[model samples]
Target: MFALRMSLVILVADVWAKTPFMSEYEFSRRRDELIREEREYAGHLRELTADEKIVDNYLEYLKWQEFIATEDKFLPSVGLEGVLDDIVNSKVFKTLKKFPKGGNMHLHENHILSKKKMLDIVFASEDFEHLHVAVDVPESKKWRLDFFLNPPAGWEKVKGNPKYTKEKLLPHMTMMGSMTEFAKVNPTNSARRWEEMDPMFSRLGSKVIANVNIKFKYLESYLKAALEENVQYLEARSSISSRLYTLDPDPKYNSTGGKRYIDETGGEYELQENIKFIEGFVKKNPEFIGMRKIVNSYRGASVSEMYGDMEKAVRLYHKYPSYIGGFDMVGEEDKGNSLLYFMNDFMKMYDNTTGKSLVPFYLHNGETNWPDDLESSTNKKDPVGTLQNTYEAVLLGAKRVGHGLGFFKHPYLLNKLKEHQTAIEICPASNQLLGYVPDLRNHPANNFIRMGAPVILGADDPATFGYDHFTVDWYEAFMGWGLRLQDLRHLAINSLKYSTMPKEDINAAIKDKWEPAYQRFIADIKKEACAVDFDASTNAPAISRIAPREGPMKRSTKVYVFGRNFEEGICKGVRCKFGNAVVPGSYISGQHVSCNVSGLRRRNRKGAGKSKAVGVAVSVDGGATYISYDGQFTFVRNL
Candidate 1:
C-alpha cells in the first residue's frame, strides 16, 4: 500500500509538470498581445487626431467602458487565472509596483485576511472534532467545547430547554451534505457552508476573536502579505475593545443580555499592546517605514458613545504623537449618525481640553447616493445632502476626504477643495463593487480631475474585494480616468507627499529617497523612447514632391477700378477703369475716367476734375432717377 501511494504521488507530479497550470507561458503570451494592442491603439489615436471630432467621440464612447474587466465575460479567452498573471507580469504593473506608495489611508483592520489563513483557522479549530465543519454557528449545530462540556452552569434555564442530542447536532456540525442541500442554507448565516460564499471567502479567512494574540497574529500575517506586494506603509482603522475575552457568558465580563463590558484599562491596554506590536515589527522590518492609527466607531453606537470613542482616539494621538495619526468616523456612513450632528460637541472638546486639534481628520464623506429619506432616518443624508457636512468639515480643517462622490453637485464646495488643496482618496473599484457606482467609468473623480482637483487612488479593503492593489484599484484608475502616464506618476508622488509622516522625515525621504528613484524611472522611459521610433511612417519622403531650383522669380503688379453705382464688380489685369453709362468718347485723364467727355479730346478745365460727373444712377425705386456718389450724379433717360 505504501509503495502504491508513492507511485501515485510521482505520477501526479509528472502530470502537473506537463500541464499549463505549472507554467506562465500562456500568461506571457496574453501580456504580449495586450501590449501589441495598446501600441496599435496609440497609433490609431495619432491618426485620429487629424480629425478632432472623431477623437472626441471615441473618448466619449470609452467613458462607459467598465474598469478592471475581471468578470469572465470581459476576460480574454485565456480566462481570469491567466489575466491576473498577465497583469502581474506586465511592464506597467512592474513599474507601478516599484513606486514608493507612502501609506494605505483606508484599510479596515478587521477585514485584513487571506484565503489560506482563513481556511487554516476554520480547519484547525478543535471544536469540530468528528465533524467536517469549519466554523461554529447556530445553524451549523456544531456545539463548541464551552457549549457541550462546560455549558455555563445555568445555560439550561437561560438558553430555554436545551434539546441536546448527538444525532440532532451531528448533521448540523458536518458539511458532508450534498451540494443541493448546502445551497438551501445562507452561507452568511451558516458557518458550516462558508466555502460557498463568494466575495467573503475570496478576501478573508474565518472570523477570529478580537484578542491580543489573535490581533497580533493577524497583523504579522497581514504585514507579511503587504510586504510581498511591495506596500511600504499602512494607516489601518480599528476599534478598541475586549470583546473576545467577554464573549464567554461568564458573570465577570457579561451581563444579563450577553453584552460584553470593557473597562477603561482594558481598552487602553489592548491599544498599547497593538502599538507595541507595530513598533516591534517596524524595528524588525525597516521597509515597513510608516504606521498610523484611525479610531473607528460602530454604526449602531449612540452619539455619546461615539463622542467618547473619538475622545479616546484623540487622547491616544496626544499620548503617542508619532503613531496615532488621525481620527475617523467609520462604519456604515449611510446608516450611522451624521458627523455634523456631533460636530459642535467635538469642536468644544478639541478647544476645551485636547488643545492639539485632537487629530487630523480624514472622513468617509459619501459612500452612497441614496435619497435622504431612503437612508436610515438617524443618518438622514445621502451623498448630495452630505455635501454641506463635508464642506463644514473642510472649513473645520479636514486634512483629506475619503470617497467624496457627491462633491460634483456643489461646485462651490469643489472650488473650496481645490483652493484648500485637499486630496480625495478614491476607491473606484470598491465603489463599483458596493453598487455606489455601477461602473468605474461613471465615477465622479473624472470631473474632479478635469476641474483641477487633487485626487489619489486607494484600495479600500482590497482583501475583501477579491483583488490585489495592482489588479484592482490602480487598474481602475488607469482605465476609468484614462489617465496618462504622467498623471499616474503625479498621483504616486502625491500619495507619499500627503501621507501622515512627520514633516521633517517626509521632506528628507522625498529629497533623498523618492527623487532619485523617480529620476531613474524617467531615465529608463527616455531610453525606451529613443530606441523606439514613434514616427516611423512619417520618416519617408512623399513621392509627389517638387524639387527646388536656384533662381530668382519675376514679380508683377496690376491696378483696377470699378463703377460707383455697381454694388458688385470684378476687375482683372493692369490699369482698368469703369464708369456709369453715357454717350461719350474715351478721354485722356491720366489713369482716371470721368463719367462723360463730349469729344475724343478735350482740354482740361479748372475744377472740372472735381465737378460732379454725369452718369446713370442705379436705384431700386422702380428704376426711378436717383443721385449716386453723395448726390453728385443723376441717371439719364434710356430711349
Candidate 2:
C-alpha cells in the first residue's frame, strides 16, 4: 500500500513541477538560472569578438619558443645577467628586428643612443683631448668622463690621465654598468650615494658631447637605428632641464667642477634652436614618418619648481604647436611630487589662460611600487600611492599615462581610459626591471586589452637596459605575455591611433602607410609558413583558412575542418594530423570535423612545433582523408 502511494505522489509532483501548480519560489529560481546562463553566453560572445583576427604566424612563434626555452630565470634585465640582453643577441631578436613597430612614443632623448655608438663618435673625433674624466675608481676600473669642445684652460688634464685607455674609455664615456656587479663590491647603495651617479650619467651626454653640431649627429644616429628596427616613427620625450651645453664655460667658475653650466637665466633660446634643428632632421629623414616632440618638466622639482617647468613647457608647446606633440612630468614618479600636489596650480593656470592649452598633459603618473609600508615614498602621506597617482592623472586630462603601473590597483581606470580613448604608453622592459611589474603574464596590460583600452609598447630608457630600438619591447610583449602577430598588429596600430597627432592625419597614415605595411607583413608570414606561393591573383583553396585561431581553447584545441568538394571514398574513416601528433579521437562530416592534437603546439621536447603542416594528402581507407591546409595554429600557452 505504501509503494502504491509513492507512485501516485510522483505523478502529482511531476505534473505540479511542469505546469500551473509550480511554486513561485521554483519559478523565480528557474528564472535566475536562465539569467546566469544568459550572462555566461554574453561573456563568451564578447571574448569571441575581442580576439583580433589571427593570421597563421609560424615563424614568429618558433622564435618565441627558442627564446623561452633558453632564458635565464635569475637574470635581471637591468644587469649583465638579464635574459633580455641574451634575447637581444639571439636569432629571435634578428626576426623581431623586421617587425614593423609603429613608433617609439616614449623615448628619452638623452638615453636613446647606445653606449657603443657614443664611444665610436667620441673616438673618431679630434676632440678626444677635450674629453675629461671627473671621477675615477681604478680599484674597480670605472670612471666618469666629460668633454669640452673648446678648452677653458686646465682641460688638457682629461686625456693626460693614464687611468683611461682606449679599452677603458668606453665605460667611462657611458653610465652603462652591471648593477649586480656594483652591488657586490659596494655593500648598500643609499639614495644619497646613488644620487652621485645620476649627475654623472646626465653629464655624460650634456658635458662630454658638449657641442651643438655633434648633438645633431647624435639625433641622426638615433634615427638610423629606429629605421633599421622597422620603427617608422618617433615621439622623443625630452626634459626641459637638459638645456644644451653652453659653448662658452663662464670665465669665473672652474671647468671640471661643472659650475660653468649653471646659468641664472634658463636656456629658452637653445631650446628654440634645438626645436628648429629637429624640424630640419624631419626634412632629411623622410623615411621616418615624422618624429614629434613631447616637452617634459623634471620630476625632481619642488611644487614651485614643477610649476615653473610647466610654464616653460606650455610656452614651448604654444611656440611649436606642430612639433610639440604634448607636455609631461618626466622623472621617477615615486620620488617626485605627485601630480595632485600641483592640481591647484594647474587649475589656476588653466583659468588664467585664454583658451585650451595646446600642451595637453601626458603625465608619467603611476609608475610606482605603491608600497604597503607608510614610509614607502619621500612623501609618506602616499598610503595608496598607485591609486592616487592614477586618479590625479585622469583628472589632469593626461593625454596618455606613461608606464601606467598603478592602473592595476584600480581596474575602473581601465574603463575610464577606454571611455576617454586615452592611450597608455606601456614600457615593458623598463617596468620589468623597475620592480613595478616583475612578470608580463600578470601585468596590467592584460586588463587594458580585455577592456579594449588603447596601449602602445615603448622602449623606455632603452640605452639604460641596453636595447637599440622598440623591437626588444615587442619581443617581450610576444614572449612575456603570449601575444600573437594579430595582437602585435593591433598594438602597433594603437600606437598610431592614440598618438597626439590629429585624427585626420593618423587616419591618412593608416590608409597610405600602416595598412600597406600590414599586408606585406601578412604576406611574409604566409610565404615563410607554407612552401606554396601565395598568389594575389589566384583564389587559394578555402581549406587553407581556419577560424577561432587562438584561445584558452587554442592549446590542445579542436580544429573544426572546412573545405570544398567531397568524395565518399576519401572521406571514409578520415584521419588528420597536426604536426607529428595524430588526432586521437575525431568526428568527421562532409565539411566539418574535430581533432584532438590541440591544433596547436609551439614546441615538442625536441624543440619543433607540433602544429607545423605542409600541403595536400588523401586516403580512401579508414586511416585516411583528402586534406590540405597552410600554416600551423602556433599554440599560445598560459595566456
Candidate 3:
C-alpha cells in the first residue's frame, strides 16, 4: 500500500511539472503588480494635465523636504496642535494656501471668522458701545459677549474696560484657552473635549452673531477671508431661526416684542436677509463665485423639535430654492440623538413612498471614535452610539456625510457610500483637535479616500477651533495622508462636484471660473521662478561648489549647483541667480540643483566685456529668499 501511494504521488508531481503551473515567487510577482496598479487606481480620480503633473512632482519633492526637516517633525507622530506653527510656516503649506480650494462645504455660519478676527471686527463696530461682557462669572465661564438695550445689573460694556483687552478676550472667545484646560485633564477623552467645546458656542459664537449688527459684517468678513484664501464658494450650515435683533434706543420699539432689542428678524425674513446679504457680497466680490446656506438644526433636539426644524427647512428650501443648499443636524454626534431616533421625522419629509426628500440631507454622522456597542440602544431615551448614525444617514439619502470617523468600521456602509457617490466632508484639524484621532494618520478619511469614496476637506467650526480659512485643514490632510498633488486636485474638483450647486452651475464654475484660476495659479507660480531679490532666512540653501565653473553667459549653459538644504520640486519659485539675472532651475537632490546659466545681466564692472566671476545664488521658496556660496561662476565669452 505504501509503494502504491508513493507511485501515485510521483505521478502527480510529474503531471504538475509537465503542466507548467506557476511557482510561488512568480505568482507573488504578478499579484504584486496587480496590487500596485490597484493602488494607483485608488489614489487618482483622473489623469493629471501637463501643468498638474509638474506641480505634482514639485509637491512630492516638498513632502520629501518636510520629512527631512528636524524641528518641523513628522506630522503623524506629533498631532496637529503640536505642529501647527510648523505647518503654517511650511513651504508646502504656503503653496497650498495659494490653491483655489473650490468651496468650504461643511462649516457653521457663526464659526466662519476666527475668534480673533471676530473680536477685532466687534471692537471696530458701533455695537461695541452696547456690547457687554459677563465677567462676574467663574474664571472658566468669563468673557461672554451680548448686546443689551438697557444694561443688566452686572454686564459691562467692552469699550475702555480694563478687563477685556484683545489678548485677554481672545482665549475665552476661541477654543485654545479651553483646549489647554481640557488637555491638562485628558487629551484623548473626546467627551471631555466636547464638554469644553459645547459651551464655547453659547459664550462666544451664538451671543456675538445673534446681534443683527454683527451678523452681516461677520458674514462679509467670512466671504472676504474665503476669497483671500482663494476659496471661491461656500455652503455654510446656519440656523436662520428667529433670534437676531439689533440694539436700538426708541421706546416705542420695545412694544414690537423685539426680545430686549429692536429691529428683530427671524424665520423666513432672516433667511431672506441672509440671501440678500450673500447676493450683495457676491456682486461686490465677483471673484467670489457664490454662497449657499445649508439650514441646520442641532441633533440633540427631541423628535418633535427636529421634525419642526426639518419642516421649516423644507419650507425655506421651497421659498428660496436657489439659495438653500440642504439640511443637516449640527452638534457633537456621540452625545446627540441618533439618526435612528429621527428616522420617522426624516421620512415625513418625503411623500408618495418613492418621492425624493423635499429637503436634501447633509447629515453630520459618525463623528465619534466610540465603538458601536458602547450605546447599542437606538431608543431615544438611551444615550446614542454614533456608528449606527452612518448607516441611518446613508439609508436616509444624505447628500454628504460629515466627519464619518466611524464609517470605516462598517464595510457595507462604506460600499454603499461609494455606490451612491456620496461625499464625506473631512475636517482633519477638527477631528484631531476634538480628540477623535490624535494621530491624524489614523483618521478614517484616509481609508475613505483610498477606497475611491468621494472626499472633500472642510473646516468644521474653524473659529471655535481657533483656526481661520480652509488651508489649515488642507495642510493637515495633505501631510497626514501623504497626499499627492493629484489627490489635492481631485479634492478641489470634488468640492464642486459634490456641492449642492446645480449641475450646470457646477460645470460652468469648473470650466469658466475654477479652471481658469487654477491654470493662472500654475502660471504665476512658474513665472515666479525667475524673479530676483529673495529675502534670505533660516533653512535657506547653502551652496558648496559648481561643476564646470565657466560657462557662456549669452547662450544657455546647464550648470550643476551643489548645495545643502536645497529644496526639491518643480521650480515654482525656485531659481538660480547669476549676478543680477535670475533664471529658472531644476532641483536635482538635497545636495544638487541644475540651472540654465543664460542671459546673465552683465554687471557694471572694471572688466567691462571679458569673462567675469559672478556670484551665483539659489532660491527654493518663490524668491522669498536666496542662498549663495563663496564659489563663483565665470561668465566666459565661450565655455
Candidate 4:
C-alpha cells in the first residue's frame, strides 16, 4: 500500500510537471470556439435564425431524452413497427409533422390512401352493399375485397358481415401485423417480408381502387391528406394499367361492368378524363399545387413487356407532356431484372426523349446490400446483386435514384450522381421496415449526405406500411441521422428543386408556398417552446419527492409528483421523466402532478443489487429543460 501511494504521488508529480494549465477565461473561450465549430458544420446548408435555433435546441433535447439518454432504446434503433405507437404519440414527431415537407417525389399511386382511408372510401361508396370479401382464403389472400352483382362462393357481403368488419379487415390489408415480434424472432427474413408485401397492391388495387369512382375518391383523399401534412406537391409513380371499372349497374358506355383503360391508345378518353379530374382538383385546392404521374414498369416484367410499357410511357409523355412527370421501373431491385436487363428499351426511350426535360428517367438503382460482384449463372430470376445498377441509371441520365442505398459503395458513381445532380430518394422508414436497415442509425444514406450527395426524403409505400403522410419519413431521417434544422430545411428545399416540376412552377412552390409555411412553422415552434419560462428562477419547477417511489419491473406504477411553481394548464407539454422513461404528467394544481412511472428492466452489474435507482425530473418546455427532484426513485424486480 505504501509503495502504491508513492507510485501515485510520483505519477501526479510527473503529470503536473508535463501538463500546462490554462486560465479559466482561455478554457471557456476554447469551449465556446468548439461549440461554434459544431454549429457551423450542422448549419452548413442554411443558417438558423434565433427563434429557429431555439426550436432546434428543443428538438435536439427531445431527441437526446427520447433516444440517447434513455435506459432502453426507443426509436430509430428498434424496428419501425415496434415503436410506431410511440412515434404517433411523440411530441417531437407531432411538431416536426407540422413543418412543410415540400413534395413527395417517390410515392406510388396505389398507396396514396391509408388502410383506414381505404375502408372509409369503401364504406361510404354507393355500392357499399355490393362489396364482397373472400373468406377462408390462404394467408396471403386474406380478406380480399371485390365488387360483385352476385356474391361468389366463399365470398360474403361485407356490409352486414360481423367477421368482415373494418376493424378486422384492416389487419389483413396493412403490413402492421406482429412484424415487431417477427423481426425479433427472425431478424433477417426480408424475403418473407417481401412475400407478404408483394400481393398488397393486387389485393387492394385490382379489386377496389381500380374502380374509376373509388380511384378518383382515393386521389381526392390523397390531396386532402397531403395538404393536412403540409406537403405541397405530389409525384406519384403508377403503372396506369389497372383495368379500371365502375360498380354502377347502369353505366353510359357499359362493357365488362363499365371497364376502361388508363393508358390504352395514350390518347384514350379515360386518360383525358382522369387528367381533367386532376386539373379540376388542383383548381379547387390551389394549395395542393398539383399532382404528376411517373409512368412505371415492374422490373420483373419480360423484356418485351417492358418495351411495351416504355412505348406506352413515351406515347403518354408525347400526348400529355405536362401531366406525365417522368418514368421509373418499380419493383424489388434485388429480386427483379436489373436496369441493365432492359438497357435496349431504356436507350431507345433515352434517344427519343434526349432533348426533352419532362420524360426523364427516375430509376430505382443501388437499392440492395449485396456486393457488386455477386453474380450467378443459375439464378437469373433474381439478380445476384444490384449495387451496380447505379452505373446504368446514371449513364441513362436518371433524374433521381430511388433508395440509392448502395450508392455510397462506388465513390465514382456517387460523384457522378452529384455531377448529374440526381437526388437520392432516401426512404428511411421503408428501408427500416423492409430489413435493409434494422437500426436506422446505421443506414448508408447518412454517408450519402456527408459525402455531398443530393438526398430527398420519401415514404416509398406509406399505405402498405400502414401510415398516410410523408412526415414520418422526414422524422426518421431527422432523428436517425442526427440531422439539424438546417439539414431538414435543405432536404425540404431539395424535394422541390430536384422535382420534375417546371422551373417557373418550382420557383413558385418554393417562394410562394413553402417559404411562407416554413416561416410560420418556425414561429409556431418558437411560441410553443417558449410557452413556459422555466429558466427563470421564480417560475422554475422544483420536484420534491414522490410517494410510493418503488415499482416492480415491467409494470407501470402511478406516482404523485410534488413540486412548486408548476404552471397552470400544463396539460399540453408537461413530461415527468423517471430516469430515462418519460411519460405524460397530469397537472392537478400548482404544487401537485401525477405520472405513471414505467418500471423498465434493470441491467445487472457487478456489486449492484436487483434494485435500480434513478433521478426523477419534470419538463414543461417540451423537454428543452428539466428540473430534477431532490431524491432518487427505485425500481425493484420484486416490490
Lowest lDDT 10-residue stretch of candidate 3: 529-538
Best by TM-score: 3
Error of 3 at 636 (Å): 47
lDDT of 1: 0.48
1-639 per-residue lDDT for model 1 (tens digits): 999999999999986775563223234334546666765532312222212222222222222223223434432222122244555654555545654454555676755554345334433444222112223344322232221223333323112223533333322222221123433332122222223223242112222334322446667877766666556567667676544322335565334233243435746666676678878987887666656767666644666787787777778778877767777777556556666666654675556554546667777775656533344334443222433556555766667778888677667877788788777888765565444554456678877765667776666665544444533456556655666544555566666666767788777656665566555545554444334332231222111110110101111111111222111100100111113323221111112222221221123223334332332232211222332332222111110
Segments in model 1 whose C-alpha atoms lie over 4 Å from true places: 1-95, 118-209, 242-264, 352-356, 371-388, 468-471, 516-639
RMSD in Å for all candidates: 26.4, 12.7, 11.4, 13.7
lDDT of each: 0.48, 0.59, 0.75, 0.74
Clash list (residue pairs), candidate 4: none
Name the TM-score of candidate 4: 0.75
How far out, in Å, is residue 323 in model 1? 1.1
TM-score (all chains, Cα) for each model: 0.56, 0.69, 0.77, 0.75
Provide the lowest-lDDT 10-residue window in model 2. 45-54
Model 1: pairs clashing at backbone N, Cα or C within 3 Å: 118-205
How many clashes in each candidate? 1, 3, 0, 0
Instruction: Give the TM-score (vs. native) of candidate 2.
Output: 0.69
Candidate 4 CA-lDDT value:
0.74
Q: Kindly list the per-residue Cα lDDT of model 3 for residues 1-639, writing each as its tens digit.
A: 999999999999975764442432234344546767777757564666656655655566566667778334676545555566777788878888898889887888788788888888888877777778876776555667876666555667788887788887887876656566546346577877877777687666776786777878888888888988899998888886746676657676555322344324455666777788888887887777788889999877889999999988888888788789889988877777888888789878887676889989898888877788786335458565777787787888888988887888888898898899889999888887788887677778888888889999789888887766588888778877868767887888899999998899999988877888888877766555323122232255688887667765565666777867664334444688888878888765556677777745545433447677788888766566777768787766543
- Which ranges of candidate 3 are over 4 A from the true structure? 1-32, 43-45, 70-72, 138-141, 181-185, 251-265, 376-380, 529-639
Q: Candidate 2 on 1-639: residue-level lDDT in tens?
A: 999999999999976776651433334345546666754532322221111111323443354345556565523223322455676776666766777788888887777887678767766666566576545333232344556545343333456566566565554433335344553233223232233334435534655544553566777788888878878777878766554453445555444443345333465655666667666766776545667778787755677877777777788777766667777877666566666667766775563456455468777767765542322346654334434778877776678988887777777876687778778999876666555555555677866765567788788767744555577777667765656555676787888887777889788767776677667766665454344222222233245454434322244544445553222212133466554555543323234344444434333423433323333232213454445566444443332
